[model samples]
Target: MLLEGKIVLVTGVLTPSSIAFTCARLAQEQGATVVLTSFGRALSVTQRAARRLPTPPEVLELDVTDPEHLAALPEHLAERYGRVDGVVHAVGFAPAVCLGQEDGLFAAEWADVATAIQVSAFSLPALAKALKPLMRPRSAIVGLDFDASVAWPAYDWMGVAKAALESAARYLARDLGASDIRVNLVAAGPLKTVAARSIPGFSQIQEVWAERAPLGWDVEDPEPAARAVVALLSDWFPATTGEIVHVDGGVHAIGAAIRPPAPEPEPEPEPA
Candidate 1:
């Protein structure tokens, strides 16, 4: 039990297919007591999904943008478990209009992009800060990430948000390391979750990932990614921090072209 007797908070679970749900499930199986957080209309959905876990965790109301909820989080968690050992900041969002509109690209408006940055990037440090007092020393903070190394067709603002997220984790790691708390990001391969389905042209990215990754990636299997999160949440990575661990089937390393080599000339056989 890597996480035996630990208490972990996982945010952004909207359905059974969500990446956060899988992380919570794995954490429970590893002997950790898990708690989930959701907002407004999705609270019911998250609750239903929580029941499906091996050991259903209590669902808490948390809208990352709500300062009131953020301030109440430490006390809220303390009411249930007394202290927290880890936190999974798996929340992110961006309006569809800002994704990749040709005419609207430059004029898409900063409001949407700014919201995405705040939720996907800045909220990480915010959550860490809010939960710091309740979090035990040597605790860990893990976040979900995509390969933000380059631009994808319709991943526009979200891509920029992820880039900011990667940078934010480094800063969080540096600041939190002095307190013996570790922060890291897991760059996972694509999966068909509610949040992912909301993105435009996500299928195209999924196809390219399958074609390029040498290990033959499975977009449906988010377990591997979840397992990586759980491992980082544990004590195994005691000396690790400010790192972006790539769990993308090695696709990030390979070039996009997977076409077979051209056939050799038939005349060569006759000459022999």
Candidate 2:
């Protein structure tokens, strides 16, 4: 019951396999009333997924890139719930050309890159701004991150966008500090979510992560990351902000792969 009596908003839940879906589910299980956001043709899919949650919560239409949607979010939340205790910015995307290329950084034109950056990075502030009115002191904002410190093989522009997101979060935390609203991120390891599978070479990252994570990694299980999000949403992290909590099973901390011990030297049977 980490988030008892809290109202958390979760976005980008396109399917039940999405990490956002798990986050929303766990939030409700922990006693928070959760609301999900989706847009356009995917709204139906999200609605379907919502039914699968422990408590089927209301799903709202929210295309973060749409200013109309962003502007109306506060009013929508206010209508249903007087205030929001937590916000989960789980929205992100990039054009196919923006990834899966050796020249990925330069592969996409400015227009494509702009979309990626806006959705994956700028939306954090936009969502915060829209919901700021309803957020009181001790309210928290958490976004999903992918450890944008290092460039990945096919992550390309999306990786750049995430780096921008990390920076944006700090700026948000700094600015929102006056209001006592905490902002943080959970950089999860690779998971078998719809978004992850869409990336061309993401599987390679998953393979390597599974091999190196000291605490072990499971691409199929998102509960660990989900739990982290709910914890931040709860009053438990009242004093924490502007931090990136890595839930990648220790992969981010290890400098090298944890190779297994060399097979025991075969007992050299000395046949005299």
Candidate 3:
């Protein structure tokens, strides 16, 4: 039980297939008491997923963009656990306009981009700050991430937001280090989560990963990524923080595996 007796908060679980849901389930199997967060219409979806876990988890309402929800998290956790040992910030969203096919980068208005950044990136520090009072030394905070170091066809502003998330994780590591709280990101490869389906041509990225990830990749299975999140949440990564661990089948390390077209058979040679 890597997470034995730990109290963990997981966000963004909309379905059993969600990475967060898998994390919650694995966390419980590892002896942690898991709590999930959802808001409005998606709350029911998360609730259904929670029931499917080996041990059903409690669900809390938390719209990360809502200041009130942010302010109330500490109190919410205080009532049940008193202190939080780990938190998985598995939340992210961007408006349609911010995605490339709908509007592309230039056509997306600042407001839409701002929404993406605030929810996906800014919320990392916001969640950390909100939960600080309830966090203990050695507590871990993990966030879900997509590789933002390079651009993809349709990721657009969401990619930008993820880049910001990468930076925020580093800053969080620096600031929260004194508190002995760890902050890190798990940059997972594309998977068939509800969120990924919303991105236009996401399959393109999936195809790229299949060719590039040296260990190969699975767009359907999120368990590998979930396992990474659980590891970061456990005591194993005590000395590791402000890091982005790519669970993308090693795709992040090398250039595309797509071979150049056989040089056109050297143009039949200059035999004349």
Candidate 4:
């Protein structure tokens, strides 16, 4: 009952296996009214997923990169819920070339890199700014994160985007604090979701989690992370903001147990 009587907006719910899906379910079970968001073609997928939730809340159209959509968010929420108490930002993406590229970070051009950062990192603040008016004092904003402290394998430019996300959260927390709003992120260990599976080198990253995460890690279950998100959305951590709660089974606290692979040797220049 942590989120009792709260109105929460959960974006980027694609399927039942997604962490956002679990967060929405837990919020509802705890007495909160949870609304979801998706955009374009994925809207249908999110709508389908909504049917499986306990209450099957309304799914709004939100393309985090769309300025018009961001502008309309407050009005939409005001029409339906009047006010919002919590926001769960689970949206993130990078073009195929932006991740697991053979050229690594060099493979993506500025256009693609900007796209990744805008959609994944900037969207947090954009969504927050959009919803600020509708959010009541003591309202909370929680974003999903990965441990960006290290260079993750195959993550490429997406890794850079996540680092930006962490920084943005801190600044958002600082400025929003005066309004009684708190911003935090939950960095979860890798999970087996469609998005995770699509990343070519991410499985390699997951392979190390079992040994690195002291308490152990599960690449299939998102409930632990989702539960932490619910806790943050509640008043449990009244003064906690601009912090990252690692739900990675303590992986973020430990040193790497496995060594990274050696780089391929450079080819010798042709005889001239």
Per lDDT, the best of the predicted structures is 4
RMSD of each: 3.0, 1.5, 3.9, 8.6
Tell me the TM-score of model 2: 0.96
- Stretches of candidate 1 off by over 4 Å are 260-272
> Across residues 130-191, which tens digit of lDDT does each residue of candidate 2 receive?
99999989999999999998978899999999999999999999999999999999999999
Candidate 1 residue 108 Cα shift, in angstroms, is 1.8
lDDT of 3 by residue, 1-272 (tens): 99999999999999988999888989999999999999999999889888999999899999999999998888979987899999999989999888856557887888988999999999999999999999999999999999999999899999999999999999999999999999999999999999998998897888898677778888889999999999999999889999999999898998858534565555556687
Global local distance difference test of model 3: 0.92
User: Which regions of candidate 4 fall more than 4 Å away from where they truly are?
Assistant: 258-272
Of 2 and 3, the candidate ranking higher by TM-score? 2
User: In candidate 4, what residue range of length 10 has the lowest lDDT sum?
Assistant: 252-261
Residue 42's C-alpha lDDT in candidate 2?
94
lDDT by residue for model 1 (1-272), tens: 99999999999898889989999999999999999999899999999999999988889998888899999988978887899999999999988887756654574688988998999998998899899998888899999999899888788888889999999999999999888999999999899998888877888889888688888788888899999999999999999999999998888899865756789867645564
- Winner on lDDT between 1 and 4 is 4
Q: List the residue pairs that clash in candidate 3.
A: none
Q: 175 in model 3: Cα distance from truth in Å?
A: 0.4
Superposition error at 267 for model 2 (Å): 5.4
**Residues forming the 10-long window of minimal summed lDDT in candidate 3:** 258-267
lDDT of each: 0.90, 0.92, 0.92, 0.93
Q: TM-scores of the models, in the given order?
A: 0.94, 0.96, 0.94, 0.94
